[model samples]
Target: MTQLNNVGIIKKANIYFNGKVTSRTVLFPDGTKKTLGIMLPGEYEFSTDLKEEMEIISGKLEYKLSGHDWVTIDGSGIFYVPANESFQLKVHTVADYCCSYLNE
Candidate 1:
């Protein structure tokens, strides 16, 4: 997770919730993609097209998947979001994260 080698990054950011959330798309050679982003304190709901592995680099937040209870991720943690579904987040502090999109 320290370095991303041989990858392409999109120049524009994916901005959401009035810029409270922002991320840049990183494209890998194997046709996989990931997003590195920062989240400011806010509540947000997101829909996913591909399965996602979200790794929190720092800060605190709570996430809720469909049919599941809210789970807290403080300091650093990782969570998975299934494809073609939605999830919610309540960010308590500024958080840095990297999300890897899975083809499977």
Candidate 2:
């Protein structure tokens, strides 16, 4: 696990999947924003308005980018979701992740 230092004010947020997934928005002192969330075992599709980097903190998930093959991601793994695109994820176990919205 990567150590995070000084994560600033965090505010809770209910994300998509009809509240199946929940996250907390972290506002850093450096003006960066991130969403830390957990996903229960299920299949879900997500759309991104901004480019995102999703890091798997624990458990595992199988995900397929748009027009790409499914790949399994374990703990500490990271994946990128392009802006204005969507991806599908199939979680077999409870997975925890951090999504960092990139400034383009």
Candidate 3:
């Protein structure tokens, strides 16, 4: 989906990597949450406390999960990061993404 509807967003931004990466917390009505964010051209590493579904909305980038090779996702794609793991990204362009925190 291009847009999110009927959701609550936290006002404060999630800033990281000296503001190279940022996102907002999106609260859903069904006790679920997600993050809508953007990544500028840079390399970044992130750790997840929960299982996350990373949906690439636009732009180009390569991501590497723990114990996996770097995979490129250009234009749009989806990848999952397991709970309690780390991942890396090489953002080639400004990328828009939506990350869903999954329970299973």
Candidate 4:
């Protein structure tokens, strides 16, 4: 296993949805790879390339999975977005969030 100590702020990332989404690749302690993201106020559509995600921070959000019902989230919460599922997120206000991806 490997470790990162006192790492600084992110320097590289990809932006989507007119800057509503930002993605960055990071290395984990177990020597694995992960992708992290930050979503701001806007409407967005995404599909996961991995099996699941673990939310690190959360706030109010509106979402809908492909062909599924829409839902809203409030406060700090953690949830999973299944792999290969297309989903959309609509932010009512400014929000800060992060999530860890599985299998890249």
Candidate 5:
């Protein structure tokens, strides 16, 4: 069975960087929000204090939690990030990912 959405897209934001980086944010229902970011061949960081993070959509990414060992994650994977922790995502090549978090 499939469910159809009755509401509309609340808010959307897009940013194109000078390099090969780009990002976008989409707000959905039930205080759920999604952000898509494209990174070039470089390192980046992800941090938050909120505890309710849902999933991540990625093409290819290398992540390190609190300066731990680098973990490579490709394609699509779901992850639950702990609260009050800082994480980093290092882009080896052209990588894009979507992060779903609680908007409230």
Candidate 6:
């Protein structure tokens, strides 16, 4: 990933998932958005309307893309999810991550 500097006009957003998950959205200057947040230890299923690249910033998580087997990812690791698809994540520890939405 390329370095992003001069991110102008940040807006904070909170996303809730039935009290199980919460993520803070960070808006950048060039219309790119990233969510920096933590995921509690549990199993979660998520559907996305846009393509996303999820990077593990701290801790670890095991995730499975649709029709795929689960794989573990650590800090600095990334996984991609295509648009209109769903994925599952099983977290054993409190995982910190950044989800970047990819604009087409």
Lowest lDDT sum, 10 consecutive residues, model 3, at: 1-10
Cα lDDT, all candidates: 0.96, 0.87, 0.96, 0.68, 0.61, 0.81
The runs of at least 3 residues in candidate 2 whose Cα sits more than 4 Å from the true structure, single-residue gaps closed, are 1-6
Overall local distance difference test of candidate 1 = 0.96
Candidate 5 C-alpha error for residue 12, in Å: 6.5
TM-score of each: 0.96, 0.87, 0.95, 0.73, 0.65, 0.83
Clashes found in each candidate (C-alpha, N, C closer than 3 A): 0, 0, 0, 0, 0, 0
Residues 1-104 of candidate 2: C-alpha lDDT, one tens digit per residue: 56557877465576777776889888777888888899998999899999999999887899999999999987659999999999999998889999999988
Q: Candidate 5, TM-score vs. the true structure?
A: 0.65
Candidate achieving higher lDDT, 1 or 5: 1
- What's the distance in Å from true for residue 80, model 1? 0.5
Output the worst ten-in-a-row residue range by lDDT, candidate 2: 3-12
TM-score of candidate 4 relative to the true fold: 0.73
What's the lDDT for residue 59 in model 6?
71
Candidate 2 contains a number of clashing pairs equal to: 0
Whole-model lDDT, candidate 4? 0.68
Pairs that collide, model 6: none
Candidate 1 local lDDT, 1-104, one digit each (tens): 48999999999999988899999999999999999999999999999999999999998999999999999999999999999999999999999999999988
Candidate 6 achieves a global lDDT of 0.81
Candidate 6 per-residue lDDT, tens place, 1-103, comes to 6555666534554656665577777768778888877888889999998999998877778999999999997665888999999999988888878899997
Which run of 10 residues does model 4 get worst, by summed lDDT?
A: 1-10
Among all candidates shown, the one with the greatest TM-score: 1
* lDDT of model 6, residue 74: 69
What lDDT tens digits, residue by residue, belong to model 5 across residues 2-104? Answer: 2225434435446444556666666565656666667787776656776545344556677777746877777766555666777776666676565656534
Q: lDDT, candidate 4, residue 42? A: 79
